[model samples]
Target chain A: MSLDAPTDHTGLRVMGAEECLERLASVPVGRIAFTGNGKVAILPVHHVVKGVDVCFRTSGGSKIEAAADHASVGFEVDSYDPSTRSGWSVTVSGIATVVDDDGLVVELEASDPTPWTMGDRSREVWIRIRTDELSGRELTRT
Target chain B: MSLDAPTDHTGLRVMGAEECLERLASVPVGRIAFTGNGKVAILPVHHVVKGVDVCFRTSGGSKIEAAADHASVGFEVDSYDPSTRSGWSVTVSGIATVVDDDGLVVELEASDPTPWTMGDRSREVWIRIRTDELSGRELTRT
Candidate 1:
């Protein structure tokens, strides 16, 4: 180990499932990773948590293409503090699809998941990830 | 189209190749993503931009598994300020491999890319992504 290692002791801890979901709900932004055009690509997106599912807005791109394929995707949210040498990251692996159901769309509408860079909101497509696995890791002071 | 969108005018800017590498080197941390077991996974890692390759250390995990398979990997780094509605993200997609060359290791040693959560640095594996594609986007105030 390099001498530059942090002076205080730290350890990696595995977070419980419920805690992972709670943390996921705490962030409004995260990244979505999907395979499109034979490459695994990732996009940072504005997101909201809805009953164990992740909802995000996109204005039709690789993400929408992947969702059309019913692709398996990974969504991640993290907070890191280099000064304290502590942080937590949560990862959700799930199937991604477009949201077309009116009832669920109305529910999600209240959360107001926003698109980051699109010119038009009316043209946005709502993508939902039906989470199959939820896990997280935290780096904590020992 | 977001009411919450930064009230000040903002636009998405595409970054050129050289500026992307400069920004990549400016930060010591980034996330490496790869396809493993039919799912894309991501890990936050300490990285060094070597010429055009991104080198990070890990004690062997899904990243190693994918590298061993000569898998295409995605490395992403970004910074965003919700208040400014501005930030930038740089992503490198490339084929990943383990670095075992003594000469290159000694050269890479000078930069010292450390593993974040691994216990023993001595057992750390250095994975390099020989970048085939490099692109970046910045959310900028217009």
Candidate 2:
């Protein structure tokens, strides 16, 4: 069950799909990338893994609103250790859509993945990225 | 001169342009997001802040290659502390293009911000993203 493995010559290894999904579910934060108003945009977001999908709450904004309308979006999360120069990065690309189901929204809120910053970021809208394509890479010193 | 500031009621503050630039230059790694071949893509990339522009090296690949052809791209770097629930995120959006200047390519490679994955990723092609718009936000707990 250990995700760690002996490093090879290149010190880099492609992570398996299961490991990628495990890492995605374990991380509470990631960056969501989407094209908004004809511009590429990336924003740090607090997220929760629901099954195989990634969901995050947002107060209405041009970027998140645009992502809801866009056909495709990118999500990335990583853990790196500077001292050891080791870590892994996981990226998921999929369709992003608004989660309008009332019951599900309430259920998600119970997980407490809301924005860490204290403010009126009530996050009325919830967006979920369905995992169409998932990939990851890990690096470690031998 | 201190990037650190007292946590306000909102627990959030807008960072000044100079401070944003300073943090970006100090970080050696970031995520690059772009729309390539009609798909959203985000990849971890090691970049150097050269003046107001962000530069990185890439070997010929569909994702990075497509980014070079795209008109606009997104770059982001962030640092978060889980225990303190504090962090800052900086994002830059601009046009991306291949750097064909032979002399300049040599100078950039000398900085050694290339891929950490050891391999024959010669990364002869140098890509530069012109920072047309830059923004950042910080979060802290009182």
Candidate 3:
């Protein structure tokens, strides 16, 4: 562990896969980063950990369009406390695809992932981010 | 305010530039999204708003490298309350560059932006994100 690698420092701990999922599942709101209109855009969404996949709901907008386009996406949920300088952030990097299958959509909707904007529940599109690249970091006082 | 446009809805309000910056300046920590290694990466960092430029510190790593690479970056600051089902998110979509000028670095450091992981202040590289495409959305009950 070199000094240049801060993750190797005593104050910061690199979280394992299980911890990452736990932190993610604990939060209902997370941000999604995607490339749209030739620029990167990040927006907040409500997500639920359905099995190993992080799922969210989006209506007719860039998010749904990103899903329809199957764009490369990054989903992140984080918590930070400036006074204590302690926090945890989990990021899921993968592709966003729309779930159109009626059976799957019905099942995913059963989980009732709240869309940030909150609109017609039946009109919402289910976007599932399936990825193996799950990483997180926890910060603590040295 | 059409049915297709969710922003014009009764609950969600599109924030102006002034409000966006205010939301950003009020928060000490924000997440940055950038493209590195052919993938979009989002990480949380302590930030300070310097006029139109939002700045943060990073050591010799992917973040600094992203600055060196002059990457297209997106910075987001948000707050959400699930109980009220309300939240506000501000996003800055722009390019990230390194502030290597000694005079400027010293001046920026005078503000004393605490890096997420407390490290040697002098050793950390300052990354400035400049963007005109600032947008935000505030969500409340309908």
Candidate 4:
């Protein structure tokens, strides 16, 4: 699609669920959204995909405390190339929970992903989001 | 500070508030976070600054509707240079509200920013965050 095409302010193409998941998995960084203190907080996280869940490590504290039992959360991954003025984004909506299974923790640690925050392991926590409600958008260069 | 120096994981050397605001003003894109249907939803917004309040034009649908009634929101802007493995990020935390003030809108529109999304202005929402709560971090190149 050409970036100079007539703009369609009312038109938004909805992407399929499966496609959104695939694209989201390809990206390494995304923002995690959750409610805290009656307001919305977004934090950047480095994530890895396992099966249909998105998982990331956090160093304890408020983020996990607020989201552990949270019924739903949002995870989004996007990439933009300013030179081309084009990018795509994928958003996944699902419940969040603390991943405590020993086996899963080992696997997650084996991945050795860099944490977004510089902290000791005192706040080690992992959150996974279900993949049922996933959607995406691709912005063409214009 | 040299990149080789060990730094606290969460220890981000603070920049002056005005410096933070100046950096934010130069950036055209940022991520807006809110609670949508009890889940976390984050969308990229093309925003402008009015003093300390961050304002952006949206479609007046999901982003606006979900953020109504003093929603706690986070607006984040960052720039990364992969070759040097260096970057800086600034986050603003505050409530989001729909603004109807014509004079402020006209001043904002006069800036003539190029919209990141292909859409007309169905809604113009302003999110105001406290300047004191704003923080930033810059990574030193090795």
Please tell me which predicted candidate would have the highest TM-score against the true structure. Answer: 3
Residue A89 local lDDT, model 3: 90
Off by over 4 Å in 2: A1-11, A121-123, B1-11, B113-115, B121-123
Span of 10 residues, lowest total lDDT, candidate 2 chain A: A1-10
**How many steric clashes does model 1 contain?**
0
What lDDT tens digits, residue by residue, belong to model 3 across residues B1-142? 2344447433577887888889999988998887766677788888899887898888756454554457778889999998988888999988888887889888887897455675554466889898868988887665
Q: Kindly report which residue stretches of model 3 are placed more than 4 angstroms away from their true locations once superposed.
A: A1-11, A61-64, A120-122, B1-11, B119-122
Task: Evaluate residue B120 in candidate 1 and report its C-alpha lDDT on the 0 to 100 scale.
Answer: 59
For model 1, how does the per-residue alpha-carbon lDDT over A55-97 read when each residue is reduced to its tens digit?
Answer: 8777655445455457888889888876665688898999988
Clashes of each: 0, 0, 0, 7
lDDT digits (tens) for residues B69-137 of candidate 1: 577888888888877666788889888888888788777877774345646566666788899999887
Shift of residue A27 alpha carbon in model 2, Å: 2.1
User: In model 3, what are the clashing residue pairs, if there are any?
Assistant: none
User: Which TM-score value belongs to model 2?
Assistant: 0.88
Q: Tens-digit lDDT track for model 2 on A1-142?
A: 2556544334467778888899998877899999878998999988888888898877666367656764699999998876665678999999998888988888888877546766556645778898899988887666
For A30-136, candidate 4 gives per-residue lDDT tens digits of: 77777776656676666888877888877667565456574577778877777665677788777788887889888887885455455566667887776557778
What DockQ does candidate 3 have relative to the true complex?
0.54
Of candidates 3 and 1, the better by TM-score? 3
lDDT (Cα, tens digit) per residue for candidate 2, span B1-142: 2556544444567787898899898777899999876888898877888888899877665468666874799999999887777889999999999988988887897877546667546544779999999987888665
lDDT tens digits by residue: candidate 4, B6-125: 344554455667777988887777788777565677777668888887887776565554565566777788776544545677778887776667776677677745666666565545
TM-score for each model: 0.86, 0.88, 0.88, 0.81
lDDT value for model 4: 0.69
Please identify model 4 stretches exceeding 4 Å from their true place.
Answer: A1-9, A113-117, B1-11, B81-86, B121-132, B139-142
DockQ of 4: 0.53
